[model samples]
Target: MAEFTVNPLRFDPYKNFKFRLKWDGRYVAGISKVSALKRTTQVVKFREGGDPTISRKSPGLNDYDALVLERGVTHDLAFEAWAAKVWQIGVAPGSEISLADFRKDVILDFFNEAGQLAISYKIYRAWVSEYQVLPDLDANANAVAIQHIKLENEGWERDTSVNEPTEPSFNSTSA
Candidate 1:
């Protein structure tokens, strides 16, 4: 029989609920959902002149998808204040707009069962791309109103450091 080798696993399976969503520096509240960071590549193909069976393949641009987050509507309209800078630029009268006042970084952290920081992604140049409010008026059903926000960023990098938060965290394995 051939020798079988196994690769060492460094991390245990982490929970989903034990996560943090921080924009710039402070943690963004009222967040109920978030999206996973994803990357996709384009395939370019070229045919050789001499041989019909010969073909060349090359990689193209890298595309990153926007992160979607939703939360229960709260009295604190802090997100609106920040989003106005990005959305209300054309309507509001102003000279040269300052990007520093609009664009901000976002960090998504995932924790393990022990409430320790396991994996994180640092989203770069994140800004409010789209915002929507869906209010359902029903006489029989009772549920909290939820607000959705889509964040578009230039790129993101996965963080493998041991930088843990100083506050309480949770762990949920529920799907």
Candidate 2:
């Protein structure tokens, strides 16, 4: 097991709203939501002939869940460009997909209340599996047009190098 440094000053957990996503060495604009990072391991069961009543279970393959990123529809082509790399329409046969650059590593950075970087996660070999250009349009409803992308990643790990930040202190003296 890995060791982690605890923050004594912090009693409350970090908020979910303070996070940013980055890919291709640059931050994507206006990413308002990101799904949780989850992984599951397959269990292998085996039992001896003598002990047929009891089954021994062991860990097998690891499966990483796909991450969904959501944001309001805008002119930013970052999401569209990456999604197109997986599959593009109206291109010459065999050249429609960008095989070399389709997969990308992304970083998810979490910030503290003071806008300081507190923690980060690195997602490996992620590629866009699903892309929604726009959500259901409703004239009567007042809501932002949201677009989303589902990224299939091989795996993800927390970046331990990003240590807990020290909370700032504000001291005032009467003049």
Candidate 3:
């Protein structure tokens, strides 16, 4: 135990809004939300002298669920184009759709209050799995239409080498 110094407490929970979403190192659009990964495990049992009461916890596979992103639809056709290529919709009959056309690495960045890079999760080999357009048109409600897109990735790795880097901004509407 050293002398009592000022304890730099960095314990405040980060706000959910200060996050940015990027696809292939470029900010495709303003994203509203990104889902988290769900981890699961399997148990193995062994036969004992009396009964099979002893069990061992084995390292199970990491389940990367569909990451959902909510953003406002823009005039750009990138999303539509990606969707078309992903599902092989309206493509040339003889043309071959390779993995490069659909899969892209995504980066989800979380920032601190001082507008600095706090954490980043690099999602590997991601592709747009699903897209939905649920627009609720109303005259009284002045709300921006939010489009949702679901992406499935192979895995994600956290990057921690950044410090006080420029914070990327997403759409204003945050949950």
Q: Considering every candidate listed, which one attains the maximal TM-score?
A: 2
User: Which candidate, 2 or 3, would have the higher lDDT against the true structure?
Assistant: 2
Residue 163 alpha-carbon offset, candidate 2, angstroms: 0.6
Residue 141 CA displacement from its true place in model 3, Å: 4.7
Predictions ranked by TM-score, top down?
A: 2, 1, 3
Candidate 2 to truth, TM: 0.95
TM-score for each model: 0.76, 0.95, 0.75
* Model 2: per-residue Cα lDDT over 1-175, one tens digit each: 6667778989998888899999988899999999999999999999999996999999999999999999999999999999999999999999888999999999999999889899999999999999999999999999999999999999999998888998888999999
> Candidate 1: which pairs clash?
none
- Minimal lDDT window, size 10, model 3: 1-10
lDDT of each: 0.75, 0.95, 0.71
Query: Candidate 3: which stretches are off by over 4 Å?
Result: 1-9, 44-50, 94-98, 134-141, 164-175
Q: What TM-score does model 3 achieve against the real structure?
A: 0.75
Off by over 4 Å in 2: 1-4, 172-175
**Per-residue C-alpha lDDT of model 1 across residues 5-105, encoded as one tens digit per residue:** 32244334456787889875788887878987888888889998997997899998888899888888887675777677675645646633446677888
